[model samples]
Target: MAAKKPWRIIPRPLLETILNNHAQHHRVPQPLLLHGPRGVGKTTLILQRLLPDWNKGPHLTGYVDFAELMKGNLGTSPGPWASWSTCPQPRLSDCRKILEHCVESMVEKGVSAGTITSQQIFTTLNKWHGLTAALRHVLQSKSRASDRASPAALWERAVFAMSRECTTAEVGRILGFGENEKNGLSFEEASYMKESVAALKLAKKIIALQQGWRANAITHMNRTGLFSRTLTHSCTDWPCLLLEFLSQAAEIDHFQPKLVINNIEVLKHATVNSESTVSGPLYHDSLIWRIIALGANERCLPVILVTSDSYYSYEAFLEFGYMEIFISREVSVEGLLG
Candidate 1:
């Protein structure tokens, strides 16, 4: 076969216009969907041109290719839940990795911008890694004598510990508890702290689950009810956890993090064997839906999804009642070749 032509990236003016409008809006902008034919350089233009610009400015950018994520899930065994095993894709772990990577990228940008010190970044990342390992050990331990607590309880305790290190008084101060204060926190401060703590909790949870301990829960599923709850709960909140993390991290007054999800078609196209009896859309209640919700809500950061499949059109998303979630834009490489 002849050598494939060098890929050329076309400037997507319409998509860029949508992104700019969202960035300048007083409220959170709608998520954007870039759909076109295969080999159109949709992924290239964003990764090469757009993301770098965002990173250099006030915004942070994160990119994840769902196709690669699917490939990574192949060698891994599904956890004890037969339902989970029947699903062709392992999404929980994928979400965990994506969140972790995004946070790490954000911190690195903060360090470079002098908003956060390098030492602080290293300390936080190291602590997160250590906590992840410890949580994994606790979950995978076969000996009941080691710890009989449910994984969710253990995770909650871990999150509480990671939130902040302080005495009772310090905790009160962080929460705006003052000696002379009569009433609770002001609305603004209360909202900020609530959001901050929630984000920290979610970050810790994502890291812990990234260890793939849920697979171990399957072995003990029949013996303990907690395992089932833990598995189901974690699986359901992957997207919410990510949105929380992004929202909290981008709490800066002026800047919003830009999230780019590449090859989102994978989520739309994934299917199990026809004989498997799996009902419902492949990703109906999964992270994809949460992403749509985040896109529709004005509270979260901006998200951009790039796909080659025509099936993921605006009308299709509308059928799912996500009409306000994504602004569809088509890009073509043919425009650049000339």
Candidate 2:
């Protein structure tokens, strides 16, 4: 065997500052924007130091490298939906991919720490994905059986099946069911389950609409009467749907989830000049804004964005109105050398 490489992580003062603040405040730290030049070890410090430290606690953590996401290596699918010609660039599909990555990371950490069983996470995620897939199948199907029922009726049944499939037992287990002497879930747990189901139902609708858009069948969709004119309106607003899905997932285990994304500068390049009419920073108009809002909201998960671009300046963040959420910080190679 070749010589094994030892893990060597240089400690950074900035990481300590953020951790100390979080420890003292007993809340998620403000979103951090770690910017530096290439080879400054920003990614290394996050992956090797901060992430490991955060994972050691009750807090759940998610790590996404945009570089990896761009290369079609992250999330459940091999590549992003943008790879499909009909799909709008950096649309809801990208948001879904990011959320999937975070949820996967949360599950992995929860399982490894023994706070949650692998079976539970696997079962839950499978059921969730299955429901969405089933809805997609129904919308996309051309078989006579599917044609027998109106798409609206088929969609309602699919949502019902999904709700029924996500039983109290499943939600209970995820919420640490046996921790108390309760026979079943409490009102709050039930409420969360209901919310999760609603979000999933909406996701199915959104996915179906996305597929329709991809197929260039929006004209046909307008005639489907599945959701009336609202379908067209809602389909274009992917960020809201994505936030609902991710927020519920973050709240499931009552774990304070942290989303750490590296190489986020890749987004700047991806959104350089799109046909999207949404205003603000190129990222602010896309899925990134929703992510930032998620972090900013105390009720939702926190986010940490990492970049290696020196040009990602304070003025840009201020202009985007993200300065309040993302405090600028830099990790220098020379500082690490000392």
Candidate 3:
């Protein structure tokens, strides 16, 4: 990976601490929404700077093009319920197909087709090696797969696909080609087909772990941009799900704090749509918030949030709960980079 350009300015003290804590612990908190005007970089802060800090270890971090995913499902885009329905249930197999085709195309296009007798090519070699290598490594190692498949083995055939620079689009193309390939296909076709199968199997395994079926009622199925009303109905059981997950985590891993969820407006919308109030302030409504309040009351989990601008309603929430230390300042780049 290359060094990224520095951010325009330093991060606020409050943002720094929250991100640090999230990085230190593995759990993402749901109350930390930084709400304000558009230019403040609320989404950029969480999606780019904050979430990367939060996901320090083997945790997977990537954004799905929710707009595209929604459009494909609903035959349109920018609908109120786009994120709710389409975002949750991702077609893992289909995703793999698209990714595989992309890689294949990059490999083939990088060099002249059958130009070199020493390195003659037959098909499109989409340059998606880096991404494919990373993903394959994760699937085989970080997740503890029973079978260990090598990257070299996955890319043995270079007829249509070559081994070269891999971009996001290349990944998509590789999967597409694999799905569209015919039987007795070339190396590229076979590799992509294999990828599709593997992705499906992995998706099934993850879904099974979440619940008995492919769709989980809570966390796995919840989308970030859901309409307040639709989201509330869909995630009505989130409180119980979150509680259950936390309890399970507590039982299995006595490790440090884990995962912090930033940008909690999504949760707020979900709660409001469900016709539930978060209680005492912040206008938060949900079983999870209630649980957090109980914990805060007992001095268990300390809840916090970052804001682009101050909202008196949030101050009221803390006051009603008799909770002190609910606020903090932002941090500088020196503090974060170090």
Ranking by lDDT: 1, 2, 3
User: Tens digit of lDDT per residue, candidate 3, span 88-121?
Assistant: 3333233323323332232222211111111111
Candidate 2, 322: how far from true, in Å?
Answer: 6.1
Q: Per-residue error at 78 for model 1, in Å? A: 33
lDDT value, residue 323 of candidate 3:
38
Please give the TM-score that candidate 2 achieves against the real structure.
Answer: 0.50
What are the per-residue Cα lDDT tens digits for candidate 1 across 1-338? 11133433555775555556655432354566765555555566677756776765466677877666555444554421112223366353354456556655553343223333222322344442434445445335422323555444545454444444424343344344565665355766544443344334435455456525554554355345332433443444434554544554464544566677777655544453322112124333355566666555535566666665545553455566654456534332122321
Ranking by TM-score: 1, 2, 3
User: What does each candidate score in C-alpha RMSD?
Assistant: 13.4, 12.4, 17.4
Query: Which residue pairs in model 2 clash with each other?
Result: none
lDDT of 2 by residue, 54-160 (tens): 66545566677756534443335443322322322344345445755465445433332333332232233343233444455644533323546643455555544
Angstrom error at residue 272, model 1: 8.9
Residue 119 shift from truth in candidate 3, angstroms: 56
Tell me model 2's lDDT, rounded to 2 decimals.
Answer: 0.46
Pitting candidate 1 against candidate 2, the one with the higher lDDT is 1
Worst 10 residues of 1 by lDDT: 273-282
The CA lDDT of each predicted structure is: 0.49, 0.46, 0.33
